[model samples]
Target: MTEKNVLIKSWADPITGACPVAEILRTLGGKHGPRILHCLTEGELHFLELTRAIDGISRKVLTDQLKEFEEQGLILRSPKNDARQRVGYSLTAKGDALCGVFGQLYDWSQYYR
Candidate 1:
């Protein structure tokens, strides 16, 4: 089928194309992203704080997840004014918009337990 046809078929209710947020969800649904978002939900946090808050996450994984989230415009990273070595991450408007969806997912998971 043509690309357009495939997309149309994918969007149909039964087999609707991948979830609307598939791209972002696939990347952000990782263990690290939820933890990162939970940390930032309170306030901006530096890399060190995130690592500590998300115990067991490797430095490399944290770095990679942050980079992906930033690139996707889901989060903002700012350099600390007093410390050039310090950077903090916070969710953006787009990221905040997903809060409801995340909450629903969390609630649904409880049903399966």
Candidate 2:
């Protein structure tokens, strides 16, 4: 099969429901998902720090988003070690790999615009 056909076939499967690409898009398609993941690419950050980094995201939304990412194995939540009781979050290898995809999408957007 050709590369194009392989891609098309991968779009859906009975077992997985969605391919890796579609799964990724569905996960990061949210308003805050991409931003939160992007922020973590720099380094691990606490809950409050992520809120501060991503402006306009409410505490509720941020909390929910972080939980989803954790469940998906995209980000790691560290234990509270400081006096402030902050929880650090960092991207896993799987999550870090997606950063390139995001960058490519950004570049593609710029090219079109």
Candidate 3:
């Protein structure tokens, strides 16, 4: 197989193990997963900034999502050195890698659309 074919086939079905696409889809399957990640891609942002950037997302949902992402090792939540003691969210290396996948999917989406 050519390199491109091998790459595509690997995502479709691994040669000797189970494909991880299902798990990836599950992690990304949500109203705000992509949006939240996209926002963080720009740099670390506080909770309020994420809320404002992702239109129509409620506080409760945003909180839940951020919690989930932190648990999954996709985001890092830390106390920022500021007067208000604000918390900031930023993507981990794994999260940044996943963002590339999202970008590929986005390009594929345009082809289909």
Candidate 4:
């Protein structure tokens, strides 16, 4: 099989193809996803707070990433109880599980770099 076909086949597998770890990595592999997750590590925040916390991210990109993360069950979105009832975002149990992993990865990278 060609290299492209091999890549597609691996990702398409029903058994190992739908690897949770791989999915998490793929989701968090890019610049925006990880940053969004990191921002939520503190606590729940509204859309504007997230936008302010993560520097250099465009609103459109943040909105897209937030939607993707929510769909993946890595984050939870709820309506705020205040007057405006704005939507807020926070890490889900699955997302919280990555807290240690992020710390360890950061430490490891620090050692290497």
Q: Write down the lDDT that model 1 would get.
A: 0.80
lDDT (Cα, tens digit) per residue for candidate 2, span 19-89: 77677788777799999999999999988889999989999999999998999999999988778877899
Q: What shift in Å separates residue 35 of candidate 3 from its native position after superposition?
A: 0.5
Local error of candidate 2 at 40, Å? 0.8
In order, candidate lDDTs are: 0.80, 0.88, 0.89, 0.86
lDDT of 4 by residue, 14-110 (tens): 7655666676788887797888898899999999999888889999999889998999898999987889878999999988888779889999999
- Which 10-residue window in model 1 sums to the lowest lDDT? 8-17
The predicted structure with the larger lDDT, 1 or 4, is 4
lDDT winner between 2 and 3, please give it.
3
Per-residue C-alpha lDDT of model 3 across residues 17-111, encoded as one tens digit per residue: 75578766787788898899999999999999999999999999899889989998999999988899899999999999989988998999999
Deviation (Å) of 71 in candidate 3: 1.2
**Superposed model 2: Cα runs more than 4 Å off:** 1-9
Candidate 1 local lDDT, 1-113, one digit each (tens): 68788665353235755565566668876877877876787778899989888889999999999999889887899988874579989989877766556778889999887
List clashing residue pairs in candidate 4: none
Angstrom error of the Cα, residue 51, model 1: value is: 0.4
Best by TM-score: 2
Q: Of models 2 and 4, which has the larger lDDT?
A: 2
Model 3, global lDDT: 0.89
Worst 10 residues of 3 by lDDT: 7-16
Q: 48, model 2: CA deviation in Å?
A: 0.9
